[model samples]
Target: MKSWGLLLVAALALSGSYAVDRNNFKTCDQSGFCKRLRGFKPEKSEYSLNLDTVLVHGNVLSAEVDTVDTTAQERKVLWHYAMRLSALVDGTFRVEIDEVDPLYPRYRTQLALDGEPKADGLKLLSNENGKLTLMNSQGHKVVIRATPLKIEFLNKAGDVAVVLNDNAQLVVEPLRVKKERIDDEDGNAVEVVSPLLCLYCFCDWILKCRQVFVFSALTAT
Candidate 1:
């Protein structure tokens, strides 16, 4: 009975009889974050790993990443992130980044992996001047560049195997409170009305006025 029920469900699913709301879906262009990141074309990355905060523990090397704000008079930190580089088993390197202190908890998918990843113990080769090098159990080197914030994996022969953030498109939109408009002179809260909303309000007022005028005309008769 259970097998028959399972087959029936599978057949219904494969038949594509389910009602899907396509209007709820959005493309990359429709999403603000996606469009902003996709349109960004920077000569070099504005984010860098703060070498002063680099810490190595067991098989993980973690550091604080700061986005440089050049809009101000002098260089300043705009946003901060906690980055972790783990040298997993079989020469696979895993990079994880998250907001240092977020307003809301961000969802991270743990279902992609079958189980917790096993990391190999990292052997620190050099940590000086803006570069940190570590070797994994498989003799692969992980080079961390601090100035522009780049991670490179090199094989035993010193050939570059993989590189991260090479295109300089690393952007982390920090979670912040939505700023409300305010009256500058009075220092009171101001409501922001969109064009569409204004149009709707005007149409509603006109509709009510027309109804009142029609009622008055009828009463005058």
Candidate 2:
């Protein structure tokens, strides 16, 4: 009887594993955010950091991030974001970016970290010529550029080990209520934008993983 029960359990497990169908999953092209990010290929970065808005509070450095819309004849600010950089203990760094005032709350993962990571001391090395440099006690350096906001991590040898937003592929989709399309008198679809409800930041698990990878690369060098 025991042998027969074991065999039945093994059969059920195998059947469950085979029930999963890979084709049911959506591909990157089918996803809106993934498609937008992967398809974006511009000569230069559309996003820029507002140097005048840079602020330093305690161990954190933040600035206003803006993106330009050149689709129209005249360029204009298409979206706004808030970027925060922090020097954490053990010579690690953290970079975060989110919409400034989103129309709706974006999804943010909370189980990524065990708890709040301790911050380390950051010494301002230089702030000029559209660049800001900071250093930690362990001789690690963090460089921030003004135009086309970029962050570079350098080791004691002054060699850049990791960089963020180097390809200008950083994208943040604005969260809004999904509304149905309506036809107007001219038989054209009229777009309707939902009202401003609330605002929040988004920190995904993928971003946290990237942060860990960067820290590992920086430390390995």
Q: Clashes per prediction?
A: 0, 0
Model 1 Cα shift for residue 8 (angstroms): 45
RMSD values for the candidates in order, in angstroms, are 22.4, 8.0
Model 2 spans with C-alpha error above 4 angstroms: 1-30, 70-73, 105-111, 180-221
Task: Write model 1 residue lDDT over 1-221, tens digit each, in one string.
Answer: 99999999999897775566668889898865666567654543377899889888999888999877655678888778888777777557767766787665654545555887776888889989899998877778888888677777787777776666665555555554544476867787786643221101111112221111111101111
**lDDT at position 82, candidate 2:** 84
Best by lDDT: 2
Q: Write the per-residue lDDT of candidate 2 for residues 145-170, one digit (tens) a residue.
A: 87766778898888897777766655
lDDT of each: 0.66, 0.70
Pairs of residues at least 3 apart in sequence or in different chains that clash in candidate 1: none
